[model samples]
Structure formats: structure tokens, C-alpha cells
Target: MEETEAATEKAKDLIRMGVARAALLEPQDKVEVDVVPSALIIGGGIAGMTGALNLANRGFEVTLVEKEEELGGLLRYLHRIYPTQEEASDLVKAKARKIRENGNIEVLTSAIVTQVQGFFGNYDVTVKREGKDIPFKVGVIIVATGAEEFKPVGLYGYNGVNIVTQLELEVMLKAESFTRNNVVMIQCVGARDDNRNYCSRVCCMTALNNALILKERNPKAQIFVLYRDMQTYGTLFEDIYRKAREEGIVFINYSPQRLPTLDKGFVNVFDEFLGEEISLLYDLIVLSTPMIPHPDSGELAKMLKVPIDEYGFFLEAHVKLRPLDFATDGVYLCGSAHWPSTVSESIVQAYGAASRASIPMSKRRVIAEPIASVVDEEKCIGCGLCEMICPFKAIRVEEKPGGRIASTIIASCKGCGVCGAACPQQAITMRHFKDEQLLAEVMALAEGT
Candidate 1:
């Protein structure tokens, strides 16, 4: 009888506490958003062009902006694509031709975006062309700026004449001017080291592709490839590696501790597989360097209110779930701007970005969660501290008739309570997390205890 009485009393107390907590809660407000149906694509590379075409075909207007005068990006410098041996120029021409025929895509060559204003789904951008600012509005923005090859300067005595980078070797191969029978190609030139700890992802395949090309050009060519680790992943790349070996191209494994050295007219490297140092005379030396992000990517990331990684590559919202989209809605990224991806990988990401951008445009409306920060305008000093502290760029202080006050873009706010904590005048607070409501719970609990 005593145990039953205690249990019943405990249940009653729990019910009372639940009721008290419910009484302290307040209703949530709705945030209505209307999405625009246009897109702005930066970088007129293969990825940018592919994304523009996909969106255009889906009946959306696209503005394709290119910093250069032409459409093809790094592809223009390549001789042939890997695994398929497709002419790089032919592929570029086909995509550029399709873009030209598409009426929905507005190509802006020799133009650069100088300024970007407004929020997601409604952006007012200013493009600079020939000292003139061209202003336009768009719903979505895609970043497809490609990467640049790292120049292996001072490493292994690299000179443009004899010891050249992979990119330079492509030019010689395309022009059929590479007549060197004794060739030595060094992999991981500027990557996979303490300076750059990430793999270029396409260097191994590039080496294999070029090595096979040289073999095909001259049957008597003797090529030696020195690599830290061969990254020939996937079936197609693996087949290419096998063919290189079948064609009698010798591959030597080297360690970073004992990198290949240039001594006199010969290259000396400690072969890890053979467990011995070997020296070889080379008529031409090819250094396989990694692809690096552009220097001005930071400026563009700031303009779009997006984030970049330590290596200057644009960061996605999530590595697996949201690989092509940014945390900022209506903005997406693809191609080498994100990482060192091959042509096919870049195209796949471009298509994925286009698909993600289409979702908001197709819906035409977005309803954000009501759990956002609320601003007490009367207490606000417009100090602009909240704007500076906000990681999502959700809050902004504007000038009103009386004075400056902070306003929250409820759609963009993640309700992280950062603005509330940083507010000097106690002007910022979350909708569901008010001071009085929190104090009510604490008081109720204290009384029960």
C-alpha cells in the first residue's frame, strides 16, 4: 500500500511539471519566401557550360560569365583526355557550340563579377566588363572556377626546356615536337607532401596517359615513371596502367624521405620495391605536379557569403550529403574549384549542382523554420557586432529613420544564439528561447525540488 501511494504521487508530480512547462511556451511565427527562377554561373569552363546548358534545357534562364575571352578553361591546354583518348579541343567545341545555340543562356565573355548583393533566391549582382558595371538579378549562383597546375619551380632542376611540368609536356606531345626517346616522369611533384597533403586525384592517370601516348608515337621509346603511390583507381584507369606496363614502361616506387635527385645529366632515385638506388640518363624529364586553387577564390567566396577550405577550394555544405551545394541556399559549387577532379567528375558534379538549383526554382516558394532570432529594435544600438559575428550572414544592421537597428533575415538564420550572446544591449534573442520562459522552467523545477 505504501509503494503504490508513492508511485501515484510521483506520476502526479511529473504531470504537473509537464503542464507548467507547456504553459511557459509560446507559439512560433512563419517565415515566407518567394524564389526567383534565374541562375548566374561563374567560370565558363566545361563544368560551368554543362551546368548552364542543363538549367537552360530545363526551361530556366542562365547567365554564364567567363573571365576569359573563350569558353574552354583548362581543357584548352590539354592534348587528350584519359582512358578514352578523346581530343580535348573537339569536346570543348561541342559544348561551346551547344551553349551558343541555347537561347536561354546569356554568354558574357571577358566579364567578371565585381559585386554581389542581396540574399539567396534573390541576388543583385554587378558584373564588370570593359570598365562598366552590368547589374542583374538572379535566383541561384554556381561557382565553377577551375584550378591551376602547381609550377614545380627549383625542384629537380625544372626548366621549361628539358625538365618541364605535365601541362607543358602536353603541349609538346600535341605538337608532336617531343622527340626524346629516353624519358623520365616524376609523380607527386608538388603534392602528397607536408606542404600539400592532398592528392591531385588525376596525376597518376595523366602520367599513364602521356606515357602511353609517347609509346604509341615511338615504339622504341624507353619511359621510366617514379611515383610515391599510383592512384589509378577505377576500371578504365586500371586498364591504362596495365597497358603502360605491357608496353614495357618501367614504374619505380620512391619515398618522400629519399626523393629523386638531379645529379649531372642523370636522375637518381631510391627504388622502394628494389630496395636500392638507381640512376637513369634522361633526354626529357616530366614532373607531375598537383592542381592548386586560384588566389582570388577567397574574394569570390566572401562576395557570395560562402566558405573556402584552407587550400582555397570552395567548401560544400556537407562532404557526402551536400557535395555540390553551399550552406548558403541557392548557391552551388562544382568542378576543380571544389577540388582536383577529372573532366568526367567535373561534369557529373555540374549536373548535380544544376539539379539542386532547380529544386528551389521549381518550388517557387520556401518556408523556413520559425526557430530564428528576434531583434528588439528599441534596445538596439546598431553597433554591427551581430553582423560581424554571424557565420551564416543571417543578421544585418540597417539604417532607419530614427537610428541604426539590427534586423534578422529569418530564412537564413540558423538559430544558433550567437547574435543573442554577442548583443551588447541585450537586443537580440531567439524566438523559442526567451529569458522569461527559461526562468519559468527553472523556477518551477526549484519549487518542486
Candidate 2:
């Protein structure tokens, strides 16, 4: 009888604790957003065309805008791709043909995005085309604006004649006009320096590829490659590097502190292995320069409200988790626009970006978290503190009839409680995280009731 009485008392205490904990709960409503099933692609390069075709093939509308008059961005200036030695023009032509045949894709050449407004799921973009404005709305935006080869204008005596960039070498190779038999390829020009301290990532492999090509053209050519480091990453590229060495191509390592000097048709470089300085005679000098961000990337970044890296390349949301996405939803990045990537890498990233964009368009609706912030207009002073402090731009203060008031953009809010902490008036309350509700739970736990 005493044991039964003790059990009944314990059950009553448990029930009382459950009731007290339940009082901490607050109701919340989820935010549902309608999605627009269309995409706006900037830059009609291989990456942009590949992404556009992927979406259009899936029965979604795609508007491809290219600043140039025709398609094939950087690929248009190339002779052949490495590893395969296939003509770069053929790759561009095939992708362009696929884009043309896809009925769902609307290609706009010689166009520039003049204005961008609205938020995710609905973006109003104005394209300037031939002295006219064309406005359209898209569900998502893809930036594939690509990069440019850095011009070593004032470095290495680059005159675009005897001395030229790797890109210029490709042009000469394409035209069959490179008649020079004694060539000196200098790697990392205008890259990995105090001014621009980043590897172009493709320079070393490009040097190897071009050196091998020169060897193929003239079996008797004496080619010397001077580099800081040979960044041949993959086995295939490493094999190419080995093949270049086998073909009697010479590679000399040089230090940045003691750089090679151009003196009267000879490159005087100190060979680290030999511990001696050697003068190599050259009929042509190829400066393997880095790829740099386009000049207009800043304007486009501001228009899209996306972030760029220190080097002006597009920054992804998270490098590991969300590599192809921006912090802002409905936007994606790919290709050399993010960094200097090869043809194969760019194509792979293009497909990944297209897949990420398909999620929202396929769903047709996005559900926002219920635990968003709420503003009490009665207590809000509208000092714009929340607006200024918000990292995600989820809150805004606007003029009302009586005074200014703060509002929360539910879809964009991550419910971080930052606004609540910064608000001076205590007008902002993060739903489900109110002070009283939290205190009640604390009190109940402390009291053990």
C-alpha cells in the first residue's frame, strides 16, 4: 500500500512538469513562396550554353544573354584543347549548335544587363540590346561571365610580336604563322606576385601543352620552359609533362626573387639545379599569364547582390557545402567566373550549377522556416538599426502614415536572432524564441516542478 501511494505521487509530479514545459510553446506559421520557372544566364560561353541547354532540355525556359555579338566566349580565341589536342572551335560550334536547336532557349547576343530588381523566385532584369530595353522575369540567375587572360603589358617586354602571351601563342598556332624554332615559355607572368598574389592555376599546364605542340610542329625546335612551380595536377597532365620532357623540351626552375631577365634576344635565367645562370637564345618568348576577372564583374555583382572574392571572382555560399550556390537563393555560379578552370572542369561545374537551379523551378514553391523574426510596430522607433545590422538583408524600415516601421522579409530571414539583440526598442521578437517563453522554461527547469 505504501509503494502504490509513492508511485501515484511520482506520476503527479511528472504530469505537473509536462504541463509546465508545454506552456513554453508558441504557434508559428510557415512562409510559402511561389516560384517562377525560368532562368536568366549571363555570358554565352561554354559554361553558360551548357547550363542553358540542360535547363531547356528539361522543358524549362531559359534566356541566355551574351555581351558579345556571337556565342563561344573565351573558347573562341583558343586553337586546341589540351590532353585531346582537339580543335577548341569544334567544341564551341557543337555546343552552340545544341543551344540553337533547343526551342526553349532564347539567345540574346550583344546584350547587357542594365538593371536587376526583386528577390529570389522572381527577378526583374532589364537587358540593353541595340538601343532598346528588354525586360523579363526569371526564377533563377546563373553567372558564367568567364575570365580573361591577364595581359602582361608592362612585364617581360611583352610586345605581342617576339614576346606574346599563351593566348597570343594559341592565336599564332591557329593561324599557322608561328615560324619560330627557338622558343622560351616563361610561366607565372603577372601572377603569384606582390601585386596579384594568386596562381592562374592553368599556366603551368598551358605551358606544357603549348611546348608539346611546338615540338609537334617543328621536331628540331629548341624549347625551354622557365617556371616557379609546375602545377600539373592530374595524371593525364603529368603524363603530358613527361612527354614534353621526353621530346627534349627543357624545364628550368627559377626563383621569384631572382627572376629571368630579357637581354638582347636571350633570356638569362639562373638554373637552380645546375646552380648557374644560363642564357637561352630565343626567337619567340611566350609569357604564360594568369586568368583575371572581367572588368564588368563588379557592376554585375552589385546588381545581383552577390559577393565576390578578393580577386573579384564570384564567391560561393560555402566552399565545401554549397560550392555552386550563393548565400542568396535562386542564384548559381560556375566556370572561370568563380576561378581559373580548364575546359573539362568548366563543363563539369556547368552541369552541377544547372542541377542546383532545377530544384526550385521543379518544386514551384519554397517553404520558409517558421522561426523568423517579427516586428512590433507599436514599439518600433524605426531607427533602421535592424536594416543596417542585417547581414542577409532580411529586414527593412520604410515610411508609414504615422512614422517609419520595420518589416521582416520572411523568406530571406535565417532566424539568427541578430536583429533582436541589436534592436534598441526591443520591438523585434524572434518567433518561438521570445524572452518570456525561454524564461518560463528556465524557471520550470530550475524549480523542478
Which 10-residue window in model 1 sums to the lowest lDDT? Answer: 440-449
Per-model TM against the reference: 0.94, 0.89
Off by over 4 Å in 1: 1-19
Best by TM-score: 1
Per-residue lDDT of candidate 2, residues 267-303 (tens digit)? 9999999999999999999999999999999989877
- Lowest-lDDT window of 10 residues in candidate 2? 440-449
- Score candidate 2 by lDDT: 0.90
What is candidate 1's TM-score against the reference?
0.94
Candidate 1 residue pairs in backbone clash = none
- Estimate the overall C-alpha local distance difference test score of candidate 1: 0.90
In model 2, the clashing pairs are: none
Model 1, residue 379: what's the lDDT?
Answer: 96
